[model samples]
Target: MPAITVSRRQALLGTATVAAAAALSGLPPSRTLARAPFAAAQAPYYYRFAHGKMQATVVSDGILPLGDPSGTFLGTSKEEIGKMLTDNFLSTASVVLEQNILVLNTGDRLVLFDTGMGSSQLFGPTPGKMLANLKAAGIDPKDIDAVVATHAHCDHVWGIMSDDGSRNFPNAQIYISQADFDYWTDEAKLAIKEPAFMNAFIAGARKNLLPNRDRLVFVKDGQEFLPGIQAISAPGHTVGHTIYMITSDGKTLAAIGDLTHHQVLLLEKPRIEFAFDTDPKQSANTRVRILDMLAANRIPLIAYHFPWPGVGHVAKQGDGFRYYPTPLQMVLDQKG
Candidate 1:
């Protein structure tokens, strides 16, 4: 056949005519297709990185959407703090904090640091997702050899029990600082008519820890929770809010649980007091001291409440501290 090609002008005119006909006939555009089904709401919440010979996995329990920081945050004006949040591209009206739970595989054993808010509704809907994330990370509750708690804060310890009040980690030993266990479980302290939340804390602790008391091993500062995990006393957030320093092959990473909540607000202003801290002065001192050590030694840390997978380093920035998140596979020269 001879060439039969439509000119550009003719093609454009034809497309316009078809569109006009469709529109006039109340029909949809030819390019418009039916709606697609909603895909999965979220992917698995887990991140894995190497800490020397050990493999560290961050299983997100989820986020806690907090109210305005003006009431909970101290040592700064609400206006300035709001500006700080804005500067960081975070929400000014509210802040969302991650509940990062760390799990380490040390060749011979699996260690979990902090069981997140189990089934508690105290913090709203976002939490209590730790178990699901853990499974998504290919770790079973029965495979966990030990559960080391930094503190007995509800967010950190409530996951020890199943909803039926049975031990969640059937084969694991539960480890926590004696000071915190005593402080939270004391009947006299619990009877002080504090906030209703404190009561919830006591009830949760009793429900979670007391059943596993036989398997509970109370640790003190400087004690080795495991062969490679040493507890560092970082008190004041709680009486015994100890930080777990994991070491192997001369490499060290610390799980600084609840040491600082917001990287910008708390880390940039380490002296800022959190209302949840038992002793605000002591908490601030511990924060500054630990941050100084981490910065000076160039050590990596996993903060429980920083952004997800909160693995990062603290550095001294003009008399204040800054959080430098360690990117995956980043290597630091020892001679640097």
Candidate 2:
């Protein structure tokens, strides 16, 4: 008989088959012979949920990592904040807030609430991914019917336009309180504020708001800005800082924009002021009032500055309130 002529491929195939069979038979398996590169990209950060008859999507605008909660949040001692953060198992060195932007589809119209930080690196470079995340959610900017800003802050209104000054949501009508619009964007107010900080805030506001002045719809408290979307004026964070009451088929969710910055720092100590608030005392009043109502009624809210996909409930605990983030519904329910 001729000597067996097994090619290198045949020999490798035979060895693989034996290893597979041995593994299936409960034998020890071979280890990986080569190294593999780790994953560099992340999955899409958008989360979608049922909103009564409509649909809601929470898209990541990345994160706003404010350095040192003690300085950014005041009306409380540094020691107090440090202890609170440590107790809660949160990072005590810095305060990181998620830019969880909300978008709604009311069948008749598509609405986007509070555009995230556009390209401004004033708070560092982590944020400004709203457009990318929005697209990842299968939403096209031109398809949005309304772009509502809870206030005129850079994190909220700056994303209205691209860096080149073109409308990011070209077809969508803009909605924002005239007070915030005028206050933040006014060149006159810039003179009084410290240029180091307020300059970019005002400049970004003007770059994103002034060009759309002719098309901007001034938001009125208690009025329905769009179908199923009502504006609720929750001031103090700014002159016209507002929160929105989104309702559909009897179900409602409060979109509290900057009403509270941190769950442990602000919510648990509702009176403690955030350094970013234009009027700390007034903001504390508003925070307590809105948080109190939400707690009593067990209403759910989406905090723009809360953890990612900030859909949760607030409950009165001890002297203040406690936040409970709802477990995300990764799959569609029977209704969907």
Candidate 3:
């Protein structure tokens, strides 16, 4: 690690000045407040060396606002949930769902974790900014050799193809968990769901995956996806929902997707389940177990819905756990 460069600090200061003016004028700032102007001064990219010759960069596409749903957390009162938000210094009425897609450079092969939401989504006009962000980090989507999906959710799997249904990563192999594929592909299961939203997810999975069947590889739990990456079975949010662990230079990072919608409430009240969970009790159990292990080992973790650059470590506080976002310097120095 090298000392912070003078030029970088000066650039950060210049950005802060502009943001201050915007705030004073009572105008909406163009950037997210979670990442102040000074933090934005440090490029949106975070890097870490892995597997001796590999490097990983976490990139941000954008964030979606999750409106207040009276029953987001199962069996939790709205008033109680409001207080949880306040205690965590977050807005009670709204939640920002962050979208992150990671790039892995293994020296010989380039891989992407999830494709992110495609450009046609409601979140933003440019929903699939993974390619654009990749370019900023000096990576070409065409050069990617594989696209590993944690599950078949629309946001995580839709970007596999372009707006016109053409393969976005033309030369890459797509990997998904076997259990996840089987559950989503069953037509009988789709018929049982009446919710339009749930139907859309089922339809999208079928459409996006069917055509690429020959290219899709089914991964099993505890199997090595790559030289330093292993799949961990973490179900309940969805059948076959899985998490990935990347180890390098004695450090490990767990990429847990949608395990918890809101970090504050989920971590603090693991016993309370969320409505979105397919199996509420099972999800709660997995949540508690995972949080306990993370806190015990002091392992760093990343959540797809957590705040941008969503990398952090868990610490046990009272009967539950607390999420402590990684310091900027530590984030910059981790070995992916």
lDDT of 3 by residue, 230-300 (tens): 88888888788888887766677787777766678888887777766777888888888877887898888
Pairs clashing within candidate 1 = none
Q: What is the C-alpha lDDT of each candidate?
A: 0.87, 0.88, 0.75
For model 1 the local lDDT of residue 8 reads 66
Q: What TM-score does candidate 3 get on C-alpha atoms?
A: 0.80
Q: What lDDT is obtained when candidate 1 is compared to the true structure?
A: 0.87
Q: Judge candidate 1 at residue 166 and give its lDDT.
A: 70
> Ten-residue segment with the worst summed lDDT in candidate 2?
1-10
In candidate 2, which residue pairs get closer than 3 Å at backbone N, Cα or C atoms, i.e. clash? none
lDDT rank, highest first? 2, 1, 3
lDDT of 1 by residue, 1-336 (tens): 123355766788898998998899889767565799999677679988877788889999898877888878887798889887888898888878899999999989999999999988887888999989988889899999999999999999999999986778999999999999998887666675665577778878887888887999988788886999999999989999999999988999989998898899997778888878889999999999988898999999999999877998889987679888877553422121
| Per-residue lDDT over 1-336 for candidate 2, one digit per residue giving the tens place of the 0 to 100 score | 233455766788899998998788886666545688998998888999988888899998899989888878888799999999999999999899999899998899999999998988878889989988988899999999889898998899889989876899999899999999889988986776553567778888989998998889998999987888889999999989989998888888999999998988898889998877889999999999999999998888999989888999999999999999988887766352
Clashes of each: 0, 0, 0
Per-model C-alpha RMSD: 6.6, 6.6, 11.6
